[model samples]
Target: MRRRFCRPPRLDLPSLFPEGSGEALPAVHKVASLGTPRRVLALLFPRLPVERLRHPGPLAIWAAQGSRRIVLSLSPEAEAAGLEPGQALADAQAILPDIILVPEDPAADVALLDRLALWALRFTPLVGVVGANGLLLDITGVEHLFGGEAALREAVLDRLARMGLSAVAAVAGHAGTALALVRTGWNGLVPTGEEEAAVAPLPLAALNLEPTLMGVLHGLGLRDIGSVAAQPRPGLVRRFGPALARALDEALGRAARPITPIRPPPDMAAAHDFADPVVTREGIEAALDALLVDLCRALREAGRGARRMLLRAHRVDGDVQEIAIGTGLASRDPKHITRLFHEKLERLEPDCGFERIVLEAPRTDPLTGVQEGLGTTGRTERREELAQLLDRLAQRVPVWRLAPRASHWPERAMARVSAFGTVEVPDGWAPRPRPVRLLRRPPILQVMAQVPDGPPFRLRLGRIWHRVLRAEEAERIEPEWWRDTPDRLPRDYYQVELDSGARLWVCRAGPMGPDARWVLHGHLP
Candidate 1:
């Protein structure tokens, strides 16, 4: 017999975050897609520190980390004065005594990066935040949608400039390679399969490795990526370890570095800032008409309809008044949506005066096409009109929806749902002659039955006694065999009319057993 051996499973170690070793980093999503891998575009904003500043001039701004006061980031003017990032505060002041220094705000920098990432979704959905001041996008096949890669890059840069942001973006075959190119000041599109060659000339520092690794690579005379790639893989792994080797492979497009795109941002928004504040309702209504026109135009172009809308009024005294409205379906009709707002405009109170007004659509869906004849009396048109009326009424009072549900018990068959939520059970599950109203809990009643299995001749409701003048044969309801419960075995429901011209729904717990209980469950109109 031949000897048999079993191999042990290999463990894949998690990558460590360079910025902070032990802390949990933001989630990175991977796309497992078919066909050729996606091409990534990395966007970097080197001026995040200066750009987010309220008074960013030719000043030097240094952010603090723990006790170290160093040059966090600087303006181009500060850089021309020989003041650079990571320089000691005392030393930076000694070099440029006139440098206007401010503390760094890492949170604001990250927030602006997030906002810009959301703004970048007009290009492609596959965009991710790289570190604190960068965004990675998987352009893939989406370049031609905006003409071409070069045009797309320029368009993005221009849009950011319009948004008061300065960004440099680079496109490459791989995310790692593209990120490297962006950090090294490489702008424009790098053709597919040329990522290695394009990034080979960049210095090792451009890879953004830890100081110790850079020092070791420098000592070994591996100053550029080309030199590092020439070394034997086994030796590099044995010396610098897996992170360095893996990075090199990723930059060369030999490894997978998938990007997790953020949630897409809402695009429907219109705002007007006023030089003079307006406090009257008439002024606000006039402003609303203008906002609706602008907002509806964008919605039409996108072929999307707003399901939920928000109106924000900024008061002169820093108070913001907001109102929200929802529709039964996605609709971009200006007249209809304006009418809904008109119903509730009286509730809007501008304490001092409104300085700015912004309208936003937070929830939107694809606009559906509906064709109608000249006269709008068609069945579909009537139902649509009814839905609209319900939507209008919903702004004032709650609209309750009732539908049949799946249940063995007669009283449990019907369920109530929200007006805009899911529809009810199928027609086959619905029973006939349902009572107008049903009680939440059935109350037991004392009854005198003249005959067995017959409707009660007289029943007591609370403190009153009523005699049944007319009655019908009891409908027997039984529990489903698969869903048997000892207590909910069977019920005999009867429709009975009292002498006082009132109808009632009563149920016997069992088939007229000696100890059977009678309960008043519902009332009929």
Candidate 2:
């Protein structure tokens, strides 16, 4: 059987965000932002898996199921030849013996869909991937930029045509409404408040129910969405389950679905559009500087500083180039931030010149005003100098700082933290005294102690013996019970001054016994 008669429901749109409350809604249909409905543009690639390869032929992609090979997707030509997906390879060959069959690559198809979704960001930053062959763009406030909804749809469709991909697209007040319309081969704009009238005549296949549920509905002579929605909802939910009712409600705009964007919209961003494409390096830099000035003013007004900023260069040829920079300290200085991107500006490939430049601060930190010290060489000045040095060094290499972690275990005592952030150590929390040179893995040593449970009097290195002139009181160090294995043993560490005047820190594992091991942990300076 072919998918020509089947409409795959909006099954993968995660119903994560619920209405009114924070509690998760049951997995029925994905809904979000209960009040004013937003416009969603659903783009469906009818033959993505085959088109991605760009192989010119009557191609039918197949996958092996046990001993049987079946058609999974077909190229435009194969579909025109009456070859459909789900048909057995042997049967398909009988119809067209010269058909070119390629194995299905679902992973490649998914990756291409993700890339296409990113490319769709040129329309709106809020683009979402639907299943393996579709994309949903939340073009709510973005329609006016490309003239209107109809013009925006044509711009998108025309762009795809140039890219050599066949796509069917629809715009509706609800994502589910848009998705259902496109899957059922219905194209055009379904204006807000008129979703029911537009979706009613579509086939029940647009509801995208389970195959068995579809068969049951077909047996009951309910072929179109209007007939199914006309029946009492309680009776349908009781017999066929809630999925059918939910799908119908979503398509009719009674419910709303949110598009989880591929990239979360930036916290703050500024964009500049040029009347003509900017091809020269100086022109690109000027555009970037203009964007940064606006972006920095916004940051200063919000009392915030950007820790990481991203620059997206939208080329005239429908390609996006991105350049990102991270700071050692959150900053809003336009000139300083511009200097950071000086070395990276050469990396921007101005393919056919860039028509638009967008600068976004994906991450920001609170930068409230603070009182400065009276002296000229104040703490603020010192901090600014330090930040400048770190930022400069970070441009050439990765830079970070060490912060203390609250753990008794030596290995867990420290953590690597962002250099831009402050490390807050709790008051009265003192770190354990550690030797100057501590070994990650302590070396084994043979030791003779005056008492079975006392400190060592003599110790043997690889080929030499050192007599202990004096030994400090043993310090018992226990393993962190919550973190260490149950069978792990405690150690008694001792600082010893040897006959040769060399000081060594040694530890004995567990209680004094034949199995007790002596290890040189570090050299005490």
Candidate 3:
């Protein structure tokens, strides 16, 4: 009987932004940000254009509008030559004759921002894109995971710098506060309720206002957020509009906003924390046993099975060891899944004692019921045992694949697949008396025969000759004519005993014609 496995559901992840957005993305207005523990972090990428340059040397990137070209970013050498952002291209060229200028690519920038946001998920699950040049993360209750807020901040900044990004990171109780403070060019944790004072000195342009609105604010001498907030609420609303007031209120922690993370949260997860770290394979297996129990229970209750799952081992010293497993079919069988994990764990390197182990099944699918019979159940159980053994051994050694197909040619009789996938033998209907071990390719040998189609009397293979004590009748196996690479001959296979009592399976490539070739194909032990 053939075995059946379940398949998982599909998912399609989207890109960052649609094309044609040349300038900075407008500040995102939150719709309904989660009201979790307010720890929001804003990560600013100040030298994005300069860092994204394909080559190392000094370079400047600019944005062009017809005949008008303005500098978007400048390298250190260009800066030394008095070329700054917002300078006209004509003036910049006159100042620095040797600088290379690249055009701005909004689509590429958005894609890079999307990838960076995905990378930032290593720190927090609540990462959101901030405008075009920044990312917002809600570290919240997870700060202690990496040794509190300060350590996590340092780790984030250090990693960003190592990735060649010049970034500014600020954490606060509100997303808006973190957004404003990161632009203030400081890297520290601002305590809750200090958002107003923290951002009081930043220029009003930091509000990211429309150019006309910024000019209006400048005309009214409202040069900073502190001065703008000090004005009468109605006057600011009536003159500058509600967007400014809302932005100011959000900046000051007066309004709540929702941050949309790049991807949706994981669907199912099971984790365990140990008081004492685990160091041995036996301990890891025991923990995995308990975790699989919990995970299988959850999947059973939901009527779903995991198609892909990741096991993460968080060591006490801040290093994480992870192993992932995937199946073409969904499975919620704890014993089967645990066996797979055990097979993989043999090669997993753990640098330190692991204090926590978490298993996340990010993808799952429905598993409908299957009927079982007494005789069928017995056969299925045996097949399952055979499958488990094959799976375990395949990890250590390469195994040939034999699928459900039939052919007369010994070498091309069955399908072969990779060692990692399922091992299947074609129907248990192979012809009797065939050699148990067949060579990959039959080797031609010199043979002496008494008659045209008779068995071999003597075989010469390289420097050794084997005298046949007994020879059996030739078994001719024919080839199929419909194959793409059709075999034009029939094989005359024979079983013979040599003078030294060794048994051999030899064949003639075709009928004993004038040009027939004798080949040694297998040995019987």
Candidate 4:
């Protein structure tokens, strides 16, 4: 079954005001500035020569001549002259002797409009994107809050001008009339029934048509909106297709248009603008406390807790100082967040007075209650204390100053491991039953020794002669023959206990060969 939904009544504010005041009302002056003009230049001129340089493109240079900077369409003359919509100054200059500049970044313009739309949310949520650089907001029931439509428009315009943006706005019966009127530099509002009369005089280009389509209409002698509106609907559709017909209907208030708004994330963010810039630590802490309270309230309302908080201090000198802290668990408790900030506050140096402070909770989750009976003097607390102690020891001592010894391989039985705090110790691992005094790297020994497959009776290491009192052969480990290099001859490893209660890890290179040699690798510690 086909279903029908009733259309909501259009928001009308004209009835409440006097006859001349409502429709003939003067538009408030507002401005919307695109901060990143280079981005705009890039979007307009992809092949412009100015992009070849390492620095910023010459937007100001191109915009110097108003006529050269204005373009009617993307023409072959435009392309041949190195004039794309968003070309760089150097590239444009190289191709065309006379060209005007139009900055490129569509994204930045879109962003600015989006921000304006967000601020407009305070007035009305029914706002929609209009073309690439404009926004349409339906301020129906919201006019009363600002005292009237004229007052509301004034407030919006004042806020925009303060932010350094220029905008043309009109309140009319239809979107088409409003757009046409704004382009004609008409500031006053248009009456409900007068939309058709007001829009008829404006050029067909005001319908937001592509350059080609507008050119074709101009060629056909249909120069304005009234000419297009007067044509038969079927004939217009047959000649220009459904797009033109639909656009006509939309402009004449026969069709309804809706808008979507960009909303902030559910996580809370609060900002404080100071009456005067403050550079002291105390001033920053005070601002942080206020923001924290606001953020906590927001999180509580959403039934969530923050796990991480970021504090940003914007100084008057254009420097932005940021500090971040994480709580291992989720918590919306203002005291806890304030305590974390207190610890980090000591590290920040507020060089110049800060004009604004912003607090953001980027990560949050539902909170779970703490467990009971977890005493302050528990094993977990002791472990944490021990870890801290070890961390301190590692920072103070060099990595080469410590060793771990075990009775296993010849050179590896007593490995020389780093003493850094980052090293992981394996669980359930036990040390060998050997003497604690071990050498860092086994010194090479000259042996007037005996036995080919047995322990040596006499040897000299580091100018000290030692005789074997008791020797227990641990076992022989041969190097894999396929993996042996030219310098690495196969050797048999051995663990020998010396006469002075010291155990040594030793290896014989070129094992039992004609060129046999004795070399010590390490000692058991």
Which candidate number has the best TM-score? 2
A best-first ranking of the candidates according to their lDDT comes to 2, 1, 3, 4
Q: List, residue by residue over 1-525, the lDDT tens digit for candidate 4.
A: 011111112222110111112232221111112231100000012222222121332232234345445332233445554566544455566676554444444465456555555445334434556665566665544354456656666766665555444466676655655655665555655655666777777777667788898899999999988898998999999988999987777566566443343532224456565657877888888788777776776666557778677776655544456788765446676765676677677766667676666676767888544332465556755654554344334333533333444333334444555432233444544555444554565667776545556766777767788876666674555554454455766566566767777767666766554467787766666
User: How well is each residue in 290-342 modelled by candidate 1, as lDDT tens digits?
Assistant: 77776776676667788887776766544456788888878777788888898
Question: What's the distance in Å from true for residue 51, model 2?
Answer: 1.2
TM-score of model number 4: 0.42
Work out the TM-score per prediction. 0.54, 0.83, 0.53, 0.42
- Predictions in order: lDDT: 0.72, 0.78, 0.71, 0.55
**Which candidate comes out best when scored by lDDT?**
2
lDDT of 1: 0.72
The Cα error of candidate 3 at residue 274, in Å, is: 18
lDDT of 2 by residue, 346-404 (tens): 99998788766777787888987643234445687799878977887788898888787
Residues 24-127 of candidate 3: C-alpha lDDT, one tens digit per residue: 32221111224545678789887787876645656889998778999998877788878888999889888888889898988888877887786665554457
> Rank by TM-score, descending?
2, 1, 3, 4
lDDT of 4 at 61: 23
TM match of model 1 to true structure: 0.54
